[model samples]
Every structure is written in C-alpha cells, then in structure tokens.
Target: MADPGLLGPQRRALILDLVKRSGAVRVADLVEQLGVSDMTIRRDLDALARAGEVEKIYGGAVASGARAEEPGFEAKTHLASGAKAALADAAAALVEPGSVVAVSAGTTAYAVASRLLQVRGLTVVTNSLPVADLLRDNVADVAGTGPTLLLTGGTPTPSAALVGPLADQAIRSLYVDLLIIGAHGVSERAGLTTPNLAEAQTNRALIAAARRVVAVADHSKWGVVGLSAFAALTEIDCFVTDDGLDAPARAALEESVGRLIVAGSAEDSAG
Candidate 1:
C-alpha cells in the first residue's frame, strides 16, 4: 500500500506511474494501492486524463497511447530528432526531380519537406500548413526554382494538419507520383494510425491519390496503436525508418512491407 499521508500530487504521480507501467489500472486496484478512497482515485484519474497523461476508460485508466492523446506539432518536433532526420533523408532519396509528390502532416513529414526543397521542378501537394510555409519561405534559396506547391484547404488540427471533407475532396481529384506520410503510431495489427478520425480519412485520400506511398517514421513509432487506422503495412510501397529499430521488429516489417529501408544502415532490406 502507498503511504496514507501522501499528498494529492504524489498520489496522482504514483497512479500515473502504475498505469504507465502496467498499461492500465482499475479504479479499485488504484484505491487499494494508493490507500485512498475510490472517489479520490477517480479524481486523480480525471486530472491525469485532462493533462493528457492517461486515458480514462470505464472503471479504470489506461496508458496514453496515440489513440488517447496527440501532442501538438511543436511539442513533437524535439523528440527523436536525429532519427527523424535520417528517415527524412532516406524518404527524400526516393523522389526524383520533376516528380509530383504529396507530403503528409507531422514533424517527420516536415523533415521530408525540408529535403524536397532541393529537388527541382516538382509539384507538391499537402495539407500541412507548416510544410506549405516551409516550402514557400525557403524553397527558392535551396533550388534555383521552386516546385509547384498546393495546400489543401480545411480545418486545422493541433498537429498543424488540415483535415476534413474538403481536404479529402482536393486530394481525390489529383494524383501524385509519391506520398510521403508520417504516422502517430505504427503496428502490424493497426498499421498506420492517428488519434484524429478526420486526419485518418484525409490520409486515406492522400494514399488514394498516390501511385506509390512511402511512410516515414522513427523506430519509436513501432508497436504503438492509435484510434484510427489509415493504411495497412502491405499498402505502403516502402517504409523508411531509423536504424534504432530492433532486429526482430525489422524482420517483422520486412516480412509485411514490400521494402524496408533502415536509414543510417549500410544496406537496405527488401521483403
């Protein structure tokens, strides 16, 4: 049992730690473990949920998966920086000059956009405001000429993505040679997923508009499941990720995906 004299913050911290470690915690269990009343435990869970630290479910709380909470775009920019850069570089390598490409919204996709500025005579379609701003502001400095850029108009998401019916409609009418997408979570079971349902639909539209789809995510994305699944593993033409992934996970991806490219590695692995 936890210390009976523990204050509110300390008790809540303990509850959060337990939920994170075990993936979930029943209210009854938490009350007993923390030596608190059921009502008190419930309050703690509510506070954690409001803070985006845990997801509350019937009778309990669960770890904050991508399905439970999505961090803001700026908040995610600092995470896995080197891995994201490597993944972006590898994803950029797949695009040729004069090719039309669609970029998705997310920090990793933003990295890919930075690299695409160097590729000349390209048409870029996207629903990410940051990506549009990045390309518009800096493309000319990197290349003598900038690629044709199109930004799909729609409602803005916390992750800086424009998603909804309007974004889907715009994407459906156009076709691109490639789509470089980022995922909130990646797992064999759930595939590419996002917490936002509209973003999932928008991502599906982006997939439909592309002849070839390449997904870029860091190793940390593996095995995380979000609320909505956008595409299955087999749907991607190529998956580019950092070398931080484990051998077993890499092997599993190789078996499921058409091609698995581990950035920073000496050689690429094909399925």
Candidate 2:
C-alpha cells in the first residue's frame, strides 16, 4: 500500500507510475493501493488528464494511446501550461541572436516565440498565425529591434497553422539556423507526428530547411502517437521537455535523440 502520508504530488506520481506500468488503472484499485478516498482518486485522474498524461475512461485511466483526433489550438492552449512555459524557456535558450529560426505550429512553439522576443536580431519563419500575430503586435516593445518575421501562406488548419503546397514550398526555399517545433505526439517508434497529413508534410519541410532541429514537448507527449509521422527521432538534434517524464521514457529519448534537456530541473536544483 502507498504511504498514506504522501503529499499530493507524491501520490500523483505514484498513481502515474501505476498507470504507466499496467497501461491502465481502475479508480477503485488506485483508491485501495494509494489508501486514498474515491473522490481523491478521481481528482488525481482529472489532474493527470489535464496534463495530457492519461486518457480518462469510464472507471479508470489509460495510458495515452494513438490520438488521431486533432484538438483545436485554443483547446490545447489550456493543457500543460507550466510544462509548456518551461519547455519554451529551455528551447529559446538554444537560439542565437540574428539566427534565422523556423518555429512550427503549436502552443509550445508559440511559447518559444514569446521567449524569442528577447533575442535581438532574430529572423523567424513560421506557419503559426498566433506566432506571427505575437511578433507583429510586439514590434514596438522592442523599439523596432525585434526579430524579422515571415509567415507562410497556406490553408489554415484548426490549430491555426498555415499548411499545404504554399507552406511547403516557402519552407523549402530557405535554410534556417534552427527549427523549434512542437508535435501532436512524440514517440520512439513514431517520432514526431500529427493528425493532419498536410501539416505533417509541412513540418517535414521545416525540418529539411533547418541545419539543426529542436523539438519542445511536454512529458505527457512521450508515448502518444498521432496518425502521420513527420520527422523521425533521429532527426531531432535536441529534445526539450518538462521534468514530469518518467525514467524509462527519458532513457529512451536519450538514446534516440542527439541530446535531451529536461526543463525545470535546473531551477529545482538551484532552489
């Protein structure tokens, strides 16, 4: 039985471990194992679902599986907010001033774009409408010293990304110093994936146009798989994610990607 004295985070961690190990965990079983109330177990499950760590079912929570359904941009923005911010900070640190960087579509990529505003002389190419709007609106804040922004014109996706022939063609024509991207799902086998085929193709174009690629995803994205694979894990030069990733998943990413960065660890250590 789990220690009854365990705090909320510790209890949640144990619950996540159980779900990861068995692929699913029934609410009643969790209550019995963790020595928590049924209401508490439900609350924990709700929290985990919000973090994208698990999929809630009728009486239990299951490990995230292949997610072919695409969530709208606004819907995704509310999930994993803390993890996304940490990921954004870490990913933005990899960019240098005056470098031409390609930012892909997603809430995480939009976070990275916000952080990039401090990096003077940057030239950003993107297919994300929010990223473009963010940079354009803040032009005066940097006293006209903000990064030069380029937006690819294409058919808009539900995620607010412009994709298709025009986006692919525009991305392919220019080379970028780095590519900071987010994926609908990331896995060892499937790599970076998305439900939208055209977005997948456009993401591939962004990867091809960059000298180095950095994928910023939260720990919750670890085992999730999407319908279409865009870039392989081997193609990612660096992977930045929050510290919620479990040990096995972390080891797997270390072996697959060129480098793995767990955000928030530094701050945790410093504190």
Top TM-score model: 1
TM-score of 1: 0.78
Model 2, position 74: C-alpha lDDT score: 92
- Flag regions of model 2 displaced more than 4 Å: 1-65, 267-271
**lDDT (10s digit) by residue, model 1, range 126-231:** 9999999998998768656787899999999999999998999999999999999999988776688777778999999999999999999999998776656799
| Model 2, span 59-94: residue lDDT tens | 677676645567899999989999999889888999
lDDT of 2 at 31: 86
Model 1 misplaced regions, further than 4 Å: 1-54, 57-67
lDDT of each: 0.88, 0.87
Supply the global lDDT for candidate 1. 0.88
Worst 10 residues of 2 by lDDT: 262-271
Clash numbers, per candidate: 0, 0
